[model samples]
Target chain A: MFDMEPEVLERFTWYMREQSALTIMFHTKVAEQMGLSATDEKCLDLAMRADGPLTAGRIAELSGLSTGAVTGVIDRLERAGFVRRVRDPHDRRKVLVEVTAGDLAKFAHLFEKAQQSLVQVLSRFDPDEIEVIERYLQLQIETFRKAVINT
Target chain B: MFDMEPEVLERFTWYMREQSALTIMFHTKVAEQMGLSATDEKCLDLAMRADGPLTAGRIAELSGLSTGAVTGVIDRLERAGFVRRVRDPHDRRKVLVEVTAGDLAKFAHLFEKAQQSLVQVLSRFDPDEIEVIERYLQLQIETFRKAVINT
Candidate 1:
């Protein structure tokens, strides 16, 4: 690691905290608009972010909810038409949760707005600066994900 | 605004989405550690991030919860000692939610760990790179906040 100034660290910390707060608020708003409870929406997000459909047990582990609670969440999500549970193709005995493409299409506009904001922000920097910013983002995401998982 | 390559935009979009998901998971873990529901913890976070104490009405607006629901959140936060309801000093008739310093001290270690993660990430860049990264973060936060508020 390189040497860092204390004030630099302090300012970066403030940025991280502010971003966290904003992210939480944005999710709350998105959940509200989707007509799903925040918990249920968050669960669906977990499934959507995964590379493949996730088992209920895996979701419970990732979300820090009890297995029983996750079951109820999955049930509610299915009832809301936001997600569906299906038997895993490779593992016949396993059940997996998947986000419904048809239902999610309704919210494409909301997601598009978010993407536009990112584009607007990135447009401020030149290609080289964007590369540096991208490097920082990759490192920040990797480091923070490890920290969150270990927490 | 400047022209941007499509792939660059796509990569940055993925970073934003990943970061958002991680932030939500981090908040969920922190809330679980504090023994509060995610919604209640989120409301408390809004109060903590504000420049001053927030009235129940403001919390309701910011959190996208009804005033009645915000009342319940404040009650739970108060009972759990994460926050307290106090009469506004300037307007004794108006009640405000205040994050209790003494209670928050218990989570100092957790916040400190997050700060350390930021430091680890920042240390990878030299001062000039750090400045650029900081600029990116500042703009990203401001633009994203506006988008969240409007949404």
Candidate 2:
């Protein structure tokens, strides 16, 4: 642990807050570009990130949507060809949501543009400096997930 | 332009996507805890981040809501005491949306926790390394705003 000054902490705090606001704006743009409501895009993002296919119940739980509302989200996503409902072989009664469209790849140009922007920023630093930034990002994400997301 | 291999770009891409998803989830949690609908919370976020108070028309344009729909959103947010409508002094016909709630301070614990998490992460690096991380953050936010958010 290191003793950092209050001003230093404040500056970092502003960075975090600003990054967070930009992230929300970026995702809003992403959802609009995808022609999905923010809620639907968020659900699709949830399903896409899961290690395995997620059941509707699970998505509802994760997204804080009602079971009934999740049904509607699945319906819209299905109609848009973004996802498919499949029965779980292990549990025949459960309907799992799977992202059937490489719909994400369709947006690769946008993501790649974002990646390029990141590349441009990273290019300014030397390898050793990049290492420090990478370490900070990795730790920030890990700690945020544990403290905020999972909590 | 520095050459970044596919693997490095890919890793950073994952970080961006993960951070985006987590930000949405955190906002959802904030909304749920605040008893505001996601749309209202998003609009509130927009107002809170604006350079000054926003007109209903600007909110509509930014939020992708129709004028009528924006009226409803403002009604709900106002009733909930999260925001208020003020007539612009220079343009009396224009109504501006203002966030009136000290309500965010009520959520200070959450922001404080996030700040503390950041403090813990920064403690791992020396001051010089911290400066590098700060520079990267400043550049990342600037580049992202210009390249992604504005576009």
Residue-level lDDT of model 2, residues B1-151, one tens digit each, is 4666677767777888888887878777777778888778888888987888999999998877899989999999999888999999999999999998586777667566677788899899999999998898999999998886457
What tens digits encode model 2's per-residue C-alpha lDDT throughout A25-129? 788788888898888989999999899999999999998889999999999999998999999998998999989857667887767678778889978888788
DockQ of each: 0.77, 0.71
List ranges where model 2 is wrong by over 4 Å: A101-103
User: Candidate 1 lDDT, tens digit per residue, B95-135?
Assistant: 88888989989888877777778888887898888888989
- Candidate 2, residue B103: the lDDT equals 60
Which clashing pairs does model 1 show?
none
Candidate 1 residue B133 C-alpha distance from true site, Å: 0.9
Supply candidate 2's per-residue lDDT for A27.
Answer: 83
Superposition error at A66 for model 2 (Å):
1.6
lDDT of all predictions: 0.87, 0.85
Instruction: Give the worst 10-residue stretch by lDDT in candidate 1 chain A.
Output: A108-117
